[model samples]
Target chain A: MNVILSLIVSSVAVFGLVVIAFVGVWGAHLEWLFGVVIPYLAVITFFVGMIYRVVQWGKCAMPFRIPSTCGQQKTLPWLKRTYVDKLDNPVGTVAVVGRMILEVLCFRSLFRNTRLEFGNGQEIKYKSAKWLWFGSIVFHYTFLIVLLRHLRFFTEPMPFFVPIIEKVDGFFQLYVPTLYQSGLLLGAAATFLLLRRVIDGKMRYISLPADYFPLFLILGLATTGVLMRYVLKADVVSIKELTMGLVSFRPVVPEGISVLFYIHIFLVSVFFAYFPFSKLTHMAGVFLSPTRNVSNNSRIVRHINPWNYPVKVHTYAAYEDEFREKMIDAGLPVEKGAPEPAKPE
Target chain B: MYDGGKIIAGIIIGLALLTFPIWYTSGRAAPKPEVKLPVKEKECVQPGPYMKKKHMQVLDLWRDSVVRVQQRSYVAFNGKEYDMSLQNTCMSADCHAKKSEFCDRCHNYTGVVPYCWDCHIPPKEKPEEKH
Candidate 1:
């Protein structure tokens, strides 16, 4: 099955990464390559590839005002339309912006997700599927927090908000080093998402290796990060030194830093490199999606085809000039009496 | 590209946010924290590498042992038995007299606001004269 194949391939890929990092760092002493070079390369690839993809998507011309809407269209002034309808259909720029904000921030459309099922009496039914939305929002926000929390390592004198985020994240005080909930939640959410793809028959059928790869990769990334923080326990001081060095363009591989840290960052680097090429680019693509971003107001304003060429028209006067003689012979009225009886000339 | 202005603006904003650390720390010094290692004690409650990573966990274990279980003495890896008090053991005159010099160095550098000082009274330390 495709599901089994994807699971195997992605699992092996993550496994291969661990082996590579272990062998590279512990065996070959290529800490600089793993710590410094790869991170820089990954960031460069991420930015450049993302911009390229966005530019490619941007080049696509949407000649029609096709917005996927489920609400009423704006018509006669007397026809009543609710505020919800305006948001759902988005007849203006402001409404479209509001819709997009909700869609991006809260995943409004996914919250309205439904699963279709056939009943015993040949009836079709749609049921709310909020778990996917819940899992997705949790995964995204936690991942963002975890990412932002990492800023402590990259900045010196520490950004003012980093400590605030840290306090909130570690408020429970579960463990000695302060177990961050975001890291744990991110891993759990990724697992749930992966399991949903594997367990659901429809999802499994539609799921490709590309889809499974990211989930597995993310699981591996999160696992390594958690391991470094809790189990393996990488040196925090040394990590900050290395990360601060990296951002400031002066990299140094500090002593006593574990290979687990290398594995973690290597996984991160791979993720960064893979992001633009993978479905993960939906982060950027969401903004460019015509259906979500465009307002559904074609009736109000014309949208001319950008590629349309200028057309020359055969005017009535020109037609009459060419066929005036024929028209007079045919006893049809002429515009100028056959050109002032041209014989006078 | 279509909507070039909006798309480009979005990208610029994203890049600026992503690369904040780069521009924010440009021309600034980010020297790694240098803690003054205790010269008298050759070994800590545990090994150096272990302490570097999980010192908080070790301290927590010691605290729970002393307060909850009433186990006051700790057996180091080197088979040396010692009292389990933070003040008597860790901050003893020979081990680490100045918390600001030894403890605060790495803690502040890593942005770790450990609650160790909240309950345990830190020793009086003179502010390091600025260069």
Candidate 2:
């Protein structure tokens, strides 16, 4: 039920965004608002919101020096250290950072994650969930590549790497308009992620509206973009003019840009606006996560909370005085030798 | 309990900053890009709006034809034939006497850095007429 609600709510929201783009831009002809103003608004919201959230997270203090250790820690000189897993000091800090880089770049934790299921209807079995990891990485890397490709449209004379990447992306040159590998991979990866969420009962149970929203939004954005490129073509120079105007701080809506293009941009704008508030912020938040970022060496080095406050305590003598009779009756050790157990409250 | 006040303040400030562009440009409308053309055209390969919207695409086609495929002439969208030569076509053929005022104005306004100017020599500026 929760899964269905999540999917429905997210679907409704994405559909609503599409409607606004279609009706508001195409029907009402508010080209400037949809094309320029909304995009700028989305950008501002994205940056400012992202910074605020990150800074707020930074202000949070972790009282415990806890790092989620998965392997053997460094101990005596003879002990073999699972260096990256059980991070300790400065060297261990570096190892943890390296691990973090791997985590951020390849999603190492998700790669190592396992799923539990019934093997013989009696015992449970753990199996590698590598495909989820693969899907996630493929989605992210392809998304990055596609974004880089868009820089070609935004920039003039095109950046050096843009054309190089474009050449590589369209290397096959199989057909007109030239298909990019990343665009296809992104769509495939997003589909896999959505399907995994829907098909896996445990995953569906754990998933929320936040999780489904981005997937739906991205799929819609990708669909519209693909449609613009292949099915109903848009004017390239007009798009460049619009994008160039935006980058130059002088946004102008060129005449004759298609409704599909408007839909694509508005969907992107909505995604941007939604990003900072949602779990999509894991892109930034993952770095600030205490479990992944901190180093653990509690035994080797004293760990103290800077914000810890003093608490009033009852002394052992006071406790014994209060419970001496009870202690004697229960055969528990008494501070004063036994027979004084005759005290009445 | 969490520091709700601080978080709220941060959000408010973030919102303020996000809407900063709208704040400064309040009550003012966005201006459309303007392109100036020669008074009497001998013949344009395509319509004005077509040129404005897809000159780069036209250039791309021209580049592929002249540089890569070694073609000389091509037909444009409006059924008019244009010489595939960049210097002869864009620079000389009564397109724009001085590129600084015509091509460069819009290009610079849009912050587009056209690569044609990289290899090709730009036309000399038209001398101002004194009364």
Candidate 3:
């Protein structure tokens, strides 16, 4: 089955990365390759590949001004329209902007996800399904917070808001080192997403290696990070020294940092390199999606297709003139007596 | 490009945020913090590497056992027994005196605001060193 295939491939890939990084750094002592060379290469690939993908998207010819409308259109003075309708069936540019903001920030469209249920007597039912949206929102926000928390290691002065965010994130004060909920939530939400793909038959049928790969990769990254922070503690100062050295372009491999830290960064580097080429590009592609970005006002405003070209045609008058002689010889009606016998030419 | 202006602006903003640390530091060296280790007492309750990584956890365990279970003696892995008081054992005059010099160095460097000082009285600051 596709599910088993994708699961095996992605699991092996992530596990293989852990082995390579652990062996390379811990056993072989090739710290420079794993720490410096690969991270820089991955970051460069991320930025350049992201820009290239955006440019390629921009160059695409969108001939149709089509916006997927899901609510009542703004028409007929007597007809009543609610505020939600304006956003769902946006007409003007401002309304389109509002719709896009909702779509991008809140994932409003995905919040409207529906599942179909088949009955025994050839009947069907549609039910609201919000679990995917919930899992997705939690995963994305927690991932963002975790990334922001990591800025402390990368920066020298440790930007002003980093500690504030860290304090709030560890507000519960659950464990010895002040457990951060974001890391736990990230792992939980990613697990939910992966399970949904595997358990739901219809979802599993449609899911590809691309979908499972990122989920598996993220789960691996989160597990290693959590292990490093809690179960087997790594020297935070030495890790920071290495990270700060990396960002400042002055590389240093600090002594006594655990190999788990290397595995975490290795997965991170792999994620950076894999982002642009995979479905993860939706982070940028969402802004360029024509269906969500365009205003649905095809009747009110003309949409001249950019790909439309002027087509040449032969007029009926010219065609008739060219065949006038044959038509007269066959005793058919002629326009001007066979064009005056071609002026004796 | 179709929407060249907006797309370029978005990319520029993204890059600025992504490369914030790189540009903010501007290749300037941030020297590592240097702590003044106590020369009189060299041996700690545990070894150096263990203390470097899990000192906070060890402290937490000590706090829990001292308060909840009324256990005051901590037996280190190396069969060394020490009193389980932060003030008498860890911060005495012979070991890690002057919290500002010993504790604050790495804490300030890593920006970790441990609340150990919130309850316990801080050790006295050391006098200025002679030139």
Best by lDDT: 1
- Candidate 1 error regions (>4 Å): A118-123, A315-317, A327-337, A342-345, B27-29, B126-131
Best by TM-score: 1
For candidate 3, the per-residue lDDT at A15 reads 90
Give one digit per residue, the lDDT tens place, for model 1 in B43-105: 998888888888888899999999999999899989999999988889988888888888888
True contacts kept of 1: 0.79
Per-candidate fnat, comma-separated:
0.79, 0.03, 0.74
Model 1: per-residue Cα lDDT over A1-345, one tens digit each: 577887898788889998999999999999999999999999999999999999998899888977889888899889888988898899888999999999999999899999898888989999988999999999999999999998888888888999999999999988878889999899999999999998999889999888888888889889888888888788888888888888888888888788999988999999999989999999899888788899987888889998888899999899999998999899998777666545654
Q: Number of clashes in every candidate structure?
A: 0, 0, 0
Off by over 4 Å in 3: A118-123, A313-345, B77-79, B126-131
The global Cα lDDT (0 to 1) of model 2 is 0.76
* lDDT per model vs. reference: 0.88, 0.76, 0.88
What's the lDDT for residue A321 in model 1? 93
Encode model 3's per-residue lDDT on A258-309: one tens digit a residue.
Answer: 8898899999999999989999999888888898898888888887888889
Docking class of 1: medium
Candidate 2 regions with alpha-carbon error over 4 angstroms = A82-91, A120-124, A310-345, B1-131
Residue pairs clashing, model 1: none
Please provide TM-scores, in order, for all candidate models, with all chains considered together.
Answer: 0.94, 0.69, 0.91
RMSD of 2: 7.6
